[model samples]
Target: MNYFKKLLLILIVLGAKLPLIAQVKLPALVGDNMVLQQNSKVNLWGWASPNEKINIQLGWQTAPVVITANPDGTWKTAVDTPKGNEKAYDITIDASNKIILHNVLIGEVWICSGQSNMYFPVGKEEGTWKTGVVNYEEEIKNANFPNIRIFTVLTKASQKPLDDVTGSWKECSPASVKSFSAVGYFFGRNLYQKLNVPIGLIASSWGGTKAEAWTSEKVLEENTDFLPILENDAKNEKLYQEKLEAYYSDLKKERIANNNDLSKSQLKKPKKEDNKTSYVLYNAMLNPLVNYTMKGVIWYQGESNAEQAYLYRSLFPAMVKNWRNDWNQGDFPFYFVQIAPHKGQNPDIREAQLISSKSIANSGMVVTTDVGDANNIHPIDKQTVGYRLSLLARAKTYNEPNLVFSGPIYNNMKIKKNRAQLFFDYAESGLVKNGDVLKEFEIAGEDKVFYPADAKIEGKTVVVSSEKVKSPVAVRFAWKAIPEPNLFNKEKLPASPFRTDDW
Candidate 1:
């Protein structure tokens, strides 16, 4: 072939590839069958050719929104979404190439995140440990909510923030919901039924992962208490590298000794630090979806952080603040499930969650005292968990007036002779004990030695007295691990475990 002809053919091939490289692309959350946050200015972003003019057309709106791509080929703009309805919409983007998203709904979009409980699936999958929620077959058979959409972010861990994630939105069905987060699916299902609007749920979770793994590095660096997390990460990484080197060295020696006749099953490679490593889950799983608009977040984690329960008092709220700040949404509702009763999870972890729910603005906690199993860490009663979370969103977020969503929260205690009269915040309609008598109530004198007390509902307060605890200085309810407290308000929500004294 002639030199001139070869040069011309190369130019033609390069020109064809240029068009493909410069084409517009979008994040996984902004694709087909997705739901946008309702009645708000929702952000839409993507990448195109540098300085290219991008036009976005919403199905409900007449005028097209125009934006120019930045030098790095990134473009972002906000468009107002109307109130949620049953109608499905379409979104079109025009840049170097055209892209269209179909079956887009405007509604309440929620980010469902946490550790294993939130990662629990609706139905069991083969060759996996997720044994499914309670009544796996029936739940899967009944799962047919088309208006509810779910997006499960594939599990990933990154050392730095990522721009995109690997997953796609799917309408809820028996097939799709099988692998979806059971808590997330039930939560969205409740919202769809209550609000009568399309519900979007984004499930970004990792099982057996710590809260620090889902928090940003910058947020952890700001607090000295969280410094230990970063320090431990450094040490684990170093140890992992050493172990990986030793494994390879041993493998090479064994291979030479056997004349490369080794079976793969005979050896195990050094496992890398997984989702437990600090800040990695947030960088890969949560960071990619921050720009996408949502109503709030629902979390069901904390089992892994039980060992450092005191530090979690600070870490939990800081992580909430970190997310709110990153989303630039002012104090959006952040509802979470308190750790259920189990031998591994101590009472102090639940106390830390209680403190965080009170400290963080626009936050709520769902007490699982009534639903927890002492032997089971992943409690099977996710329906109660999801339903309680929806109640908070209904009353607080959706402004369902006069609806009681929370269980009795401890307010104060007064001493009347040898009896301690306990006051509560959510017991306006009065308290009710499910059992013959209130269980888990204890009173302590100056020595702080708590003894079981006889507790009775006295209108909106509980009066507890123990002959052993004369002149009581403090009172506690459900203060031990695996406590089955019978205390509740009229609404049937279980009272959160609480103590009057720090000690």
Candidate 2:
């Protein structure tokens, strides 16, 4: 009996020791078909047993990097990447165990994120609501770019920041591209075609989510304008249980009324889901991607924040600053699409986006005034949106100085004797009205009442005049909530909406 006890004790000790030798793990991004940012030192991190020595070997480089896990079982190392090419690479890591990442590429890795428009897929397989883009069948059939890779973050929301997300790199093909974000796919395709380099797209977008959901909590806390959001969220949390109980009671009453054929109108609305809570998605979707190196980011959200458009001017820039700070990259390129001309969107939100684009360094905004559909919030012309974004990338990020990527933007206005002369910027090759007649221009006098103004292109400046207004103090162009833009640059890019009056 003593001998049996000794054997059992020895087995128990061995079992306890087995778990101490933890198997080395990697983040979801550092896997098969992944693309590392080219010509940069990209961060590669993972977890292992405390004090364990981790060895990393890159197929493209000769020197192997060695690191030690911290007390918390986390380790990080940066590896140098070569310029973008078609060659496939490998990464081998060994610690308590071995992990080999296959088919890695060196190229421009971009993060495509925002709301429903950015989440819309290239084909119909994503869900019942995501009914692919226009000519999606042809687009899918032609999506065979072997050099382009895609990684989509799984839809998940959390109140606290997560270390890693759930995703895997996929090579671009008909089968794999079917469920990919249409805007992301088209953007990558255009980049590959223009630069002739491999493109890796990381898509982390949720439909109908607000911009604050993707912004860091710290950012929202620092800004005074966003304090209301936090305060309201806290109050809402406190009331949530009571609200839920009331919802159930109301639901029960509605059920009884329905059974009696009386009415269902008394049913109460349930509290908003946790996913819509501020900073939830950032904690889940964006926090895990903070360290991943990327060339730039493309955003396509703002409709959800239209009600708070006035606040977005401050909040949006703060969010961009927060992202740049977390990435430790100095003002990396950030291009965004202006909210299209849908009935639900207001001019305030569009103006806020324009303000962000103008204020944020190394950033650009694509205007979708002409392409937006009034009936459908998710416009089917995603191709034009992607194409315009690529133009900005090609011009700004890729060092193509000769490319005219932007349409005419209002530079300054001169009011002289009842006529307003609007000087424009980016009127490359001169400005030309889209239709036979110029429209959507309004001029206001000192009384602040606006009247239809006759606008005509005179060189790079547009002259606006009204028969009634004797002294035009302000001028506006395409300032309505939904406008069919009629002005375009020689490149056919539509001019962004503008108003001279702050009120």
Candidate 3:
């Protein structure tokens, strides 16, 4: 061969190699050492030179599946995930690149979402946060859900939808379970014990994140009822960056002035003009895996939006519908942990959650007013939060018999003379008080000046009467901050926080 001809061939080879190196990229969620969902169809995707071939293999199945990259340099493949133990998987693309995912498990999968309460783990505990009927250590050791794996979605907000998230899946073992959402773990453990199946939990959450952040901007814009909140988001995003910086600066100064450490799970001063709050996280985190199939979702949020109680009545339902539509799974059993008791206010936000829970279709809420801490926003007793969520799964999702799902929910009321007669839907085992008289019942006439009312459990109903109001028009139970509410069913679940009057 002539020298000129050989030199030209080498140049062509080198040019081809450069494109191979620069044109290939993998989605963060599909990187090395990841776990795929089992007993169902799991998604695997990434980017490469347009029109390149991609192949994926799993322990549960034989033979690799081939796919072609799109014009936009994206590729996707769904594997019929198998139920199995911790195993290794190799996914190869175009016979040149390969990703090895280790320690993958297959079983029932769930999504645990919310603010910090659902994000709180057993490791991040503070003594100030306490709860009732929680046995943390026992639940942890007894959590032999080896087949149960968990993948946590990081807190990232975006202006538009994303294709891949920045995290991978991990098994639900002692080592990995410590950082897993405590409530999610307990909920899965309960299901594992009851159903004896593998469980995968996807916890996508952020501390102090409002409900609007997890929802898509398009969905928010579509809902005219939620337009006000979405409008505020546009305004805040425009004015937020600088205000956020200033707010952090003040927060740092306050901590330093008080000789306190801001690193102790504390947030800084509120930004004056942060309008970009609504759709940021939706694009970054949730949009990446909008179609991840799951048996159900366990939500534990609402502290950040507690003040906007009325607004949440619309925002919460819109977000749920948006998610169900995005998943395209026909309302696959939406279950969530009711906002537990948090900081000064006891049951108002809980009531808001109850209102949203009833509003959504094919959905149920787990009441936690009985499991709240007045001083701490992040309650440490996540065991109950998870177990109760799983209980809803037991009766509603898995069709298990003899499991009580919820407390007394106000179905209807009859006002006669000075007293109101209340009837409940799920009054399983009837009504009973554990200790003091039902503490949160209040009565008011047309004036709506609430006065303490006497309450007595009559069969499945709690008759509330007030001497101050001769003709009672309304009644509220467990509706105040740090309210001494005490109405429960014989099954031990707390009665949902409710008010008879619109106000």
Highest TM-score model number: 1
| Segments of candidate 1 deviating more than 4 angstroms | 1-21, 127-130, 264-266
lDDT of 3 by residue, 355-378 (tens): 887888878988777767787767
Which has the greatest lDDT? Answer: 1
Residue 416 shift from truth in candidate 1, angstroms:
1.7
Writing each residue's lDDT as its tens digit, candidate 2 over 1-503 gives 69999999999999988856778999998899998999999999989999899999999989899999998898888888888899998899988799999999899999999998998899886355456889999999999998999999998999899999999999999999988889999999999998988999999999899888888888888778899989878898879978888888877777786885635375557757776788999999999998899999999999999999989998888888888999888999999999999887789999999889999999999999998889899888889999999999999999886898888888899988979999878995888887888989999999999998999999888999999999899998888788876998888988889998897
Q: Any idea what lDDT model 1 has?
A: 0.92
Q: Estimate each model's TM-score.
A: 0.95, 0.94, 0.84
Model 3 lDDT, residue 244, Cα: 77
Residue-wise C-alpha lDDT for candidate 1, range 393-466, written one tens digit per residue: 99999999898999999999999899999999989998999979899998999998989999999999999999
RMSD to native, candidate 1: 2.1
lDDT of every predicted structure (CA atoms): 0.92, 0.90, 0.74
In model 1, pairs of residues that clash are none
